[model samples]
Target: MWQPLKEKIKIHWPLLALAGVSALSVGMVVALLETVGVLNLAPADSAIVESELAPEAPSAVLGLADRPPAQRTEALSLIAQQQDNQEGHRARYLLATDLLSQGRGGSALTVLDGLEQDYEALAPYVLLKRAQAQTAAGQPEAAQQTWQTLAEQYAQHPAAAEALYTLGQSDESTWEQLIANFPAHPRSVEVAAKQLPVATGAKQMALLRLLVNYGLHQSEYGTWLDQFVSEYGSLLTPEDWQAAGFGYWETQRYGKAGSAYAKAPASPLSRYRAGRGAQLDGQRKAAIAAYRQLAQAFPDAPETATGLLKLADLLPQPEAIKVLDQVMARFPNQAATALGKRADRLDALQSPTSAQQARDAVLSQYSQSEAAAELRFRQAQQQAKAGHYESALSWAQQLLKDNSTHQLAPEVGFLAGKWALQLEQPEVAQRAFERVIGQHPESYFAWRSAVYLGWDVGDFDGVRSLDPQIVLPDQRTPPPAGSDTLKELYLLGQDQDAWTQWQNEFRDRESPSVAEQFTDGLMRIGVGDTLDGIFMVSNLAWREQPQARQEYLALQADPAYWQAMYPFPYEQLIETWSRQRQLNPLLVTALIRQESRFVADIESVAGALGLMQVMPGTADWIEAQIGQTGYDLTQPADNVELGTWYLDYTHREYDNNALFAVASYNAGPGNVADWIQRGGFTDADDFVRQIPFAETQGYVEAVFGGYWNYLRLYNPAIAAKVERLAATQPNS
Candidate 1:
């Protein structure tokens, strides 16, 4: 009876169910509303990394001993103190010297007066400056007394002659004796010469040459010559005297019509025009001899090469070839065009089969010539074409070693790497590839090196030891993820497309946060890359938002923030730490990316461990100082802390200059410092370009590049604003 009733109700429910369902839904909603409230949620752990507060462990400490902050600070402070006094004195002297150099002699006098009595040598120099200042200020009596003292005390030095010259009015009788004693001096001769009548055109022209021999670039000699020529126009041959005078004064031989009006025949200009005419007229031998004489006599003269080239053009094939050989041997860059012309002429005269024979003859006779080097390179290329892999590799290697800084070094390094790989020598090949990257990071060879190193070695199956499975992070091989979310978010910032691409690719398969980190690290240390993706993204992002722009400006103001963001590899940090006290943040970032992909515990084939890949010696040293004897080197935070601290020390040691400090960190302080002194590094970039160590050079560049990328992507606004500011400058 119940079953029949339920069936009837279910069948009739459509009509009744609509009303019942509405009431039940209302009741359920009311019940659920009382139990729940609105929920606002953020990430479980949302905190931005502060560059300043971040721990920077000495990179070496990852494997060795670590120093506690108190002890490390104490040690570094003592070291700094040890050199402070000397550094201070040097700084003061430089300041004073700068003031003097800028023509603020009175200010320099005040600084010199403040010097301590202990600065004996410097005191004398300051006194000299004071005397010069007095003279400049028109206090002749005061200046005279100062000069009298300088002449008495510093007689052996050149100061005495200078002082005596300045105070010659003190006594006429004394001045006469002084002139007699210093008769060989120019001032004495000048004094004697002033008593005579002024020189005429011929006499003036002759006098100008005498001044030229003594090394002066003044045009006074030229002025006198012109006056003489104008006054005695009818007495002398205008062209002869004018040409002679031009010859003497036109040392640079940049012959404008009026430049050589006041010199004698012995001048560089006279020799240049005469030699040029002779060579053009086909007096080959005479021209060659004349050019040799001119060039040998006046090595710094601009006409030197002009004469030589003219001479070479006029000579017969045999003599011309000899002259060309000499030119190539001595001045390769200057003679490149001539050498190529000669090579082309020879090639035109010979068939393909005989070209080699002709080149060989040239090489055999002129082994040291630029012509020979080019010929040899061509021969090597031929060998490569013919599949003589070993021969080609050998030749390329010789060229690379012999002319390491040559213009063709990149090409040679690339070829060596390629051929070495073909010959089944991975180590040699890697070295060759490294050479290209190290010496010419901006070249096509560097790009190729990155590609070859980053390619999936596994894809090229038959190539042994390449292991395409092992991919390096820096290479832009396979494209990065094409995630639309990342694209939109990145572009919402500054939208520097090129930099975005680089950042996306550089981050590659790494975690997004880590990738962002890598980008931010590079921008602070001036690690500029035209194609760096991280830099582009950050630049754009900063451009898009005011808040992000502020963060970037803050980062730029704090160098340490940039320092912590560095991705130093184990080997490089260790090397840098050994020499300097601080690490360049860009370099650190690049190394970290390359060595560990930001993984702290990663080990290498050589038994190196932790973030910096420290060996046992490194670990022990770090352990001893920090008293964290049992600390694990594999821990990420620990390794980063230890590495950054050591880097800080390097910076402290070198007074925060990344160049000297970084080089010392890579090569050792003593070594880098010696190189600095030896290399005479007046310009920073020039010094970087001239780094002799291939590994060290590449290490510096990549690390700095990585750091720059980090800052550019994350803190875009500062760099963006910098661009604006640069544009506003008058010179910009």
Candidate 2:
């Protein structure tokens, strides 16, 4: 019986291979290796027959191979299948969520429209989202109606409350009513208070009082002051009026404060402050007269010093200097320290020549003060601007050497490098660039240096590059084997019959591969057939373009290729990068797929190489700056790490404009930025067509299209919407 079964297995080798080996076989092999005390198999597992096995265990090599689309699509499909999408409801809801994330509120409403009852519990949510979408899509009346309905039907829901608040914000009276009705709601309170004051707690009341007294009011300024004086008259004492005047003076509303202070004659402080306000208001003679009177009325008062300074500064320059000298003589040792400081300030306020003299005096007298240090830096900048490179360099060097840990150390270093470059010192410029890269890899300057040297450009990360010349076949046939293992064996030994079987079986699973094989393989994986999925994928290109997959076979045979494939669990790597960079995992995976297609040594039409498809210029620039030129860009880990960083940089540069930045990465910033300056685009679709470069235009469409599909397929929430949208929207 066993012999008959064996014979039967021999006849149907594909089925037997499926039964004897699988993802589980890879896991078992790994476990067996571990059990034998292999400390780190990464270094010594070349002969391992992990992914080449059959499908008896369906849990092996889920993330192997250099290809990304097949794997990412499979991952998304498997994940979606594991989740429960009840009819079109879940899919619709997911579609709405995805639409919302992608800033497509109107589209989201269309998705939610068909699931009115199915999404009833989420109806208020959908309505609120619809309201926002309506507003964004320029349907204000519709938005208002949607919000009103939400308020009427689901007032208790948070979304309903938010919708109501939004409606109130659209109209002041309605907002006031909302606040009056829902005083406990913070948004209502905030909205009402913005127009009409509402002092809730003690702190709030205090802030309101301060705002009324001192806030920059828009013609409503005097209204608040008048209200405060009327309602809180007892609190508005002479001193309060004086403080209000000071507030007015601080806000440059000297006229209003003076009017308030002039009304309060009992407080000398108010009168003095009012006079100062008058001075600040450009009524210098009036200020001087007021100060003189105050000084006469209160000779020994503390206000005398302020009054004297006002009087002295108001005098002609020569006269003022004479008065300052007299003040020093008469008030000797009484306010001597204050007098000297005042004299120095007055001197600094003099003409530029005099100001320079004063700055030198201050530096000599008080070398440790912040003002002196600022003066020094300012003088240095002036010298640099004046083309006194030697003096500028000397000052910068002195600052760096003296203030070793100064906040301006980097600035000085940059300036020094610039100066050195101006002096024709390439070695110095190179060192400066290296210093920035070494000491501040995260700095904008370092990033600029990398770009200048053509290294690690964020825009070039993970570019989809194919060296159409070398690895690309000259037109070959499909794998001949019908089984994955036999196919592997035949490829290993160049057996034509087995290779043919491989090709036929691969095509049997999916005849046309426009990203559908990815979904099919993932479906197989979801149903507990992991090895089948990988086999379908790794050998997919070979189904029709056997030569392509055959080339991969030869490449895969290299231990280094397996090393790249085995060490990284693709899902885990994607997950880690996505989370750290605040990006979608499937998006990152899709980028990697388009870029290297997991081929660590792939090169592009633009001369980009390695897993992330970095340009040679960028690689060289990065090498020089990092001081680590020994790295092989063909290694997966190095490629991934650098690619991730570059992606992060591009994401940051474009204000998280993934579509624009990704396009820029492929086409070039000159093209993208130029297109952006052209304007008039309403949405991503419009923007896509408006792209002038045909290659970049297609690249953008393909990447984002791929990204959208992956996002929907992998993330259950996104997948649901994608499926629903695919059914409903012609574009999807």
Candidate 3:
């Protein structure tokens, strides 16, 4: 529904990131910052899952496992002693792991003794930990024997891969077994790395292929794949090329991907990718030829349409018109855009008559299309820029007559209303504002309309203090894909193990099923990988294939997608600090998600650090004012406390106006002060459009849009209001 708007405007919400940070000191700090949350062993809502075991199981996950391991070991031990039932398994395992990690392995061994027999479902993990405990306890022989037993007995288990990896540290042949049996195991990456320098022939190719296929999309894998192509290009099969091409493509080595895709299996997609990659790689002639070949070979395929458009971009005005003419004739769905592009080409060719005819054809025949809407929108903007309010209103109304439900309609309606106010037409402005709030309650424009139309949603200045009720889900959405055991592991808060198991199962990295990708995203978030997690989940929107897009739509029909996209990370810190600063918690959370995506120690290009992206200079100023010292910006608590205090300061600077404060946060005070002083805006929304900086303009919308999503997704009352408003509108 919002697809057209996506091309015309930045939606700003559901911006999922594919998150992974390398093991820098900062990475360790992020882990430490998020580990307590990652523990998932803390007190949780009773409704964490729904099952026969939901009562005991969720508590089982929480009863003894909810606290940080180091802080709550003895408490877990006491709980384990109290309950030797099924729940004791979790308690004991937690106790044992704590003991092992803290180097009291003998104590861990006593706790873990015979746990394999009792906890049959987690027997492999038990055995693996037992071996680790043995090694840590200086029982080298016992550890060796235990590793051998695990490798020999549970060789098929994912945990057994770890055992084999450990044993292979001393024996090369054991790694060979690991490579042969568990190619997808993460340990295989290690095995490949360990043996890569010494390997040759099929053995060497096999290691490279393993890394290429399941190297976790690391940067080095791109270099390795390049070498593999260099040495064994002739020996590689089409399937190998497909994998290699995907690796190169993911790494943005478009030239390599173009080369690899040329050798991959002949298909519309491969051909399109080959051309597209070539285009991006700046091999213009190759790209043009590939695109032309694709259009000829797969005339009816969707890729041909995309390829043709790209092909036209490489051609001159005259030649581009011909390609666009072909698109107009062949693909009715794309004909509007084709006509619009052709009009520009015709104008560039100085054939004004032909250009007007082309544009008129679009407005008359494809009036409802995104192209027509955008064309009309441009006209409106041109008139508005020229101070022709009446003409601008006419064009915006014409745009809405065709596309009232489009993503841009809300913005247009709001603009029309604002323009009406400029023209002193109060009734027309009120009706236009009503249309925006009625049709697109989720949009930022609706929030503006609500404030102008006198709804109680709060305004730019008042929104910061309005503490809307927040609601957490009764239970997390069940996994859309993966094994029951995978679900079990996830539900139990066994984050590391679950992620490892998921990695072993999720082999179709290049072309994942929607459910698989969504599951992948959820697991990533489970392990404090919010950037990647949100990315994997939210990127489902880009699926182009019919089945994939259908699956994506089905997944999105549920509330799960939105919830996961706007997850409540670092809530404890956000709420505590927000209360401390007398700011809205949701607003703080929105800013944090926008700033660092809940990555505790993330540093931006501008040297802003931590969850709120506070600059060192600002932090120093804040410290001097508050008389606090020695606060690390990388720490979540420290960052939030400082950031919220600054947020408060910014609010005070603008007389408690959130709009000005959020703008100040991104563009800094000097720019904001300048914008405010030079403002000719009618209201806050108009003020946004007048902001000279595109990034700051978008930042204001993004931050507020993020805030609205949090409120809509987490606040039941506001959600019901949005739904009620949407229900009254025909195509909202």
Candidate 4:
């Protein structure tokens, strides 16, 4: 039987202090190891792999992208076994690709013979491949004919652009035709780069913008921007300056970004970014002037609060304290953080009495403020850490009552529930968990609440038995902005058309609306650039723009909004692997979302690869254990197959304890075992709260949070339950 913590226990602050010191030491060690390249933490793997593998050969065969080049032989062999169905058709196309890669152009053409009708989506690619093969086999006339056929038949396709570029090797007119007809295709970048020196005025500006929007190489773009600015700085419009600022900012040229933004727009956000850029560039006086100007010009803007905060950081203590006080008085919700800083400064100045007074003032004057709630929440954490569960519960409850609408409300409510469980107050804990679901269903903590309530979604044991039904929304509203044609393209799954259209029309990149950002992310995802797409969508949660935040908050009220946000791409692959491993498909999907954001070829700094981020060493070990070989971690199917097997293995190690399994997956069984031994944590919440590694702790929350989001967004029963709880809330 599971035992809750006893209601009464001796409490001491010194014990909590000791725990904090120990956790900090552990964190430092982990950080040091990571800094020196010893710790192979999972989340950092993607960035590492991307930088290391970027210059390698492209990892796709007939659009089966991200597979390792070393696996071409294995892939070809696998495709040979299935030559009768749709898989067989795909296999043949890939087989041709493999042959072409190996300079066996005649063999590749032989394999591609008469398959044009069968591979409709890949027809242009097949022809292009065949043409290259012909050229490789020294049949120049045959290659020319094949390229001409592709150019004539697939003029609108990207393959046509490639074909034109190839034909342009001997004829400049063909390149000019490519530039005229397919200006949005990537090959146009190459054409424009070659022609940019002779281009003038409007044409030059247009080409520059295209280069920036398409994310050209940094060295090349920087040279282009510098040359363009030097020649045309005085002739450019505010919009041109804005575009230049965005391009510079994206490339981390903060000094240039600031200079450009200073001349671009007078919007609060623009001014803030200008100041931020200047600050980062070490232009202290200019940054201060920009901040002051923004504060005076747009006092009511959300940027003004941030400006004031930054200004305080640069000012003398007395001036800083005054600015901090102003921030707390004007932006109470945002003020708690500023006030906390003020309290810390007072203490640091050896004014303990003053610090106490300042803290008391926040509690009394801003009792209903977020700062007060934060103070109370901190106190609760301290009490809990000190083993004073009853006191912690009281403070947490007070925070809930006073600051229910504050951003920290969900976290406080969840913590209160955890403390209640520690105090053996099951009923109180249940209500607290219910309140979290009712009031803040979109939060990661809401998922934690669901786990405690024994929902089958990512539950320790229930996941093994419960079969969840996935219910997708029947109708999705098109994004509010964008042309009707572009919207239609997106709705119709004409991803390339929609992407090109979006790039051409998406003008305010610096200050896009929440909807526009979301749409932009969707467009990027649609075009198979998962990294940037996921970055854009996931970044919305941190936006400080008042209007954008309000729009996001309003959108969160709708279930469809979340469904779009946490989309389930690669459903067939996820389902096949989940079923094979006897796991919930949604759980597998959630894990993939966290691991790689569904980016098939993303590698982490720790060298974890593909959708589930399995490390190379782990893959080798799993292969040995499962008696499987020739699996490519970069390929989606292979990665998921091996990843899910590892997931299942972890579950079995802990007797289906999802919490332990997830932690073990991230930090490894060795580290998890050490933490378990050190903390002697039996309860899930207790173990999570006391987990020494902040990285592992966050990973657990994120994985389970993603699991709950999938459930409420996709499972009808869970969605209805969430809706019902939300409807019963006082705010609702």
Candidate 5:
């Protein structure tokens, strides 16, 4: 049996901390991901694997490699016995992988014999594996010859880099060849990692530049950039400055990014970002200069229009008003936003007549703009607060008519439904709720609407114990981008190879296509990068380009996109604990996602740790109550056990009302108790609105929102219901 290994990649680069970086491949093992090169394999001892290995419908012979290793072992071996077809070719290659993993090199060699002649998609990898088999079989000379053969024959391929890396183990010269030929490959990344600590001067800077170019600059990039600036600033080029600035910006080093961008090439985007970065970093003087330069140099550029708007923030009142006037006159697309700002400034100066003119112009000229929608929403909220539901309903209705696809449409529509109910109009309220469910099923409001309309999904009050059934996808979806080889490697559970191939191919870090970005997100999720993966997928709504946004809208219609956004990382543990506590597993999953984005060992700044982000003090207290000790907080099993126990306690305190229980989890029971006494509201929804703590309110909604998403995406019955609602016309 080829058991899975539990070992870290030799050189770990903390994946893009802001968003792009992620630990790699999640199917059958926790393998090295992102910029790290996977150089060696270790024997496994029953390591974790996800559901992609579940049996699939039969058809393609190549897909047999996707089945679970143990389950498919016999089938693959028997298939390997046939030597004439592509199925046999793939079977032999796969069988060799298990053999190599188990250190049965002689057997692996026997199966891999002549595989390069038959396996065209992975011929280079076939050769590379053969070298490993030779070494494992104690035939060092054979391995050396095989490595040299692979490196020479497929010098242009990614596998050639691996061959060079293996050969470089004894001969120091092959490292340079690997670096020269496959600079973006993870193995080349390893070469830089090996040489960086000892190398300095031009050599050190070269290595850093190499790493940065490969998008290998992860969490420590900011520190590296700082060193490059302080010690080797003279060596920097416009491109170098741009790379450093990008790394600094992504890692939240705003101050450094601002300075670097100022020195970078004079692109419209760079100039605008320099000012924005400076503004964010609190350098008002630098920001003003940068923005002023942008206004003068690229007056026609869209980024400059945005830059001028930002510039208004730092300018004096009179100067800001002048800037806004200029923006409104010059940029029609940005005119509404600029006019709204102008109105606010006029109002501040007590010029009501002028302010009213600007406000009217916004509605008359740019009715569909975001600023107009905001204005309408503010009025609706004001009217509702004043208990004039008729006026509120009118404003909400108008806003939806004008800005149906606005970011705030879901909230506004839901508010309209509530206001209609307040006005004693049951039909209007039901219509509003249905429209929200139909048009914005992905929104938090949709879940609230579903509950109000009496969907079977358990409500906040009773969701604690419902055992909703869910069905996991049997296999990974074929990625929308990447070569056929990359897709095959990924879907077949060859995660390590797929990760390396992906990193090598994906060089569009700054701007990527919808397909590329979606593919990137899928790869991240496949490898257990819950945070990076979800962020990449969910933020597609913010796409600004027209075509990209259209593509995103189309992508939204796919169930796989929603599924990728809400994945099941620890299903078994969640189920066991939820059953023990008589709680909903989906609720637990949602809570974990909100708490830590399902990063098993993540720790919060407040000393909360692990999947549930349980406080160490809370863990200690729970241990005292449960009569258990010597548990690690970073481990998923212990953390979920303790976290679920605490969750159960909170649910009991709140009579299993999930809203109050989830609130208590974040805000503490004392604050929740205080709220119940102090809160003066009509019902649970009203209570949520009146919650004093903004963070707590957001946290509560986020958890429940997450719960709703998980339920809809995973539970077939709910998924069908939501899909039906989404497909309906607004009124229908």
Candidate 6:
């Protein structure tokens, strides 16, 4: 959703309030002026200015957490004084929370009073807190009444679930009601954990459903699922069997899922999952039979096409090719991928001629298909990799000519432009780049094309001076699919409400449409589950579903699509660190986005911590060099400060080239130095291409791609300039 320009416009107040200035002593006024960057007499003053200003603009919600207790108290006091807006309510809430933590329950209750109507999204939470404060203040009867009111009014909210659990602590009747009314709530898991011991039949099944659907990934749920299957397998109904199968699937118990799904084979999805689960569980014969049955029974179903493709992969050579041919004939739009796989096998079998023949068939038969475009682009890549620039250029040109509207067309044009440069065809390269700019102005590669055309969009040294403007429309159009109410809730920033509504509405977990999955991802992100949301949305790029692909294509043109994909979670930390290090903030943001996906507390398996994924040893070295101490690497500000220092060090080591610095950041300075020596590559693009480590190569592309996306989506000036470039480019 597009925020109003008023919201986007930030007004930075001086650190010292004007009202207090007159009362302050002369020394205090000078100190305050120095703190706010008003004193510009010396280099030391600049350093002091940065240190004082950096922490002042932390993330709106998370900044309070980063502040010291004293600062937090002062901040909240200021906000509470202006109690007339959202910030005021937020401040009161935080102040109450802090007071409660300090055992000032009466004070907390005073702060929370009358905030119910003003904070509808957090009303249930306010009530829950009020109840807790009541209990702490020795008003147990009042607390109980508040809890009852909460449960009755906000039954679907997680706060209500917590309230019910609290009420259930002394009342078994409340516990039973909790289980009956909120079977899918997280608190119901606690109820089931207690009741499952003596439960039987329908009660047992219901408990299992609650555990499977809402419970955390724990061994106890696995144990309960196993027990339920063993005790009631023979007597369960079809729906129960299906539910059990879904439960098993959720837990990754593939073999058990297959068995449960086998009992409910009437559903096409169940049949497909039965096959997939059996295959994953190493029951090859059962998997084969299940897939065959699904394809035979549901010949016209979409799952049938997928079933045949899976069946092809499991079968022998000629038989595999025969099955692929059937898919190609029946599902032509899907055939290019099928044909490409078949071609790979042919090449692996020492039949290059047959491989070429298969690829040729796809191009000749389905030249306008997305598969054809993909196959041609891949062929261009293969030719380029083999040093046959002319042949690669030919394939790329033909791909654009034949599949102009295909998703990969811009990619082909970009590659063609790169190949033209390699082949010393500047005119051809310019035309190709122009075509990419004109035809796919929204793509990252279009930005690349713009840069190559000598637009001052920004580079490593010059980005600091570039004032990229981001233009957002007054309103954002909702996604083409999903419940209107859920969309509205999301737009209003009521993520919990949207998530709860989505959980109730989202059925057919076995086979969701692309739009459903994308919406699910959005809801997941809204609820602070960034990694799962990223996986759900990013995985759609490779989806074979025609409708899903179309939906994805449609979304690509929207700025919100990119923003959702590449969110700037820790803006203050990244900006502070980047500015301190004299680096491009967008570039730092790109690296952090790649490293941690904005998960502040995430640690890689290699022990890298926080937003920048700084390793402990590296942090120690950086600390020693900078004379900084007592820094927690798991903290966002500290991690980014150290990471940017390391990044700046790398850039200086490489004479300020971002390509080498980014590569070094991933593979380490030693490996990157060795690669530079061996490859003797001077051009940044050439250096990137010749990097031996595939992971490092991909990382560079992803980081830079993130940078381009940030510029296009967030910076209005750069976005407008690029749009103008696209408009001026010759259409042909």
Best by TM-score: 5
Would you estimate the TM-scores of all the predictions?
Answer: 0.34, 0.30, 0.80, 0.70, 0.88, 0.74
Q: What is the number of backbone collisions in each predicted candidate, taken in the order shown?
A: 88, 30, 8, 8, 6, 5
- Candidate 4 structure quality by residue, lDDT tens digits, 552-610: 77866656467666887888888988898888887778788888988898889989999
Q: In what order do the candidates fall by lDDT, top score first?
A: 5, 3, 4, 6, 2, 1
- Across 290-313, the per-residue lDDT of candidate 5 in tens digits comes to 999998989899898899999998
How far is 305's C-alpha from truth in model 6 (Å)? 2.2
| Best-first order by TM-score | 5, 3, 6, 4, 1, 2
Error at 479, model 5, angstroms: 2.1
Q: What overall lDDT, based on C-alpha atoms, would model 6 receive against the true structure?
A: 0.72
Where's the lowest-lDDT run of ten residues in candidate 5?
31-40
Better of 3 and 6 by lDDT: 3
Off by over 4 Å in 5: 1-68, 71-111, 136-139, 215-219, 730-732
Query: How many Å off is the CA of 606 in candidate 6?
Result: 3.7
Q: Which structure is stronger by TM-score: 1 or 4?
A: 4
Q: In terms of TM-score, how similar is model 2 to the real structure?
A: 0.30
Local distance difference test, candidate 4: 0.74
**lDDT of the candidates, in the order given:** 0.47, 0.50, 0.79, 0.74, 0.79, 0.72
**Which residues of candidate 3, in runs, are more than 4 Å off?**
1-154, 170-172, 197-205, 217-238, 379-405, 416-442, 453-457, 615-631
Displacement of residue 144 (Cα, Å) in model 6 is 2.4
User: Per-residue lDDT tens digits of candidate 2, residues 595-685?
Assistant: 7655566677878887668876776766675577666777766676666666666666667777777787777667778888889876554
Candidate 6, TM-score vs. the true structure?
A: 0.74
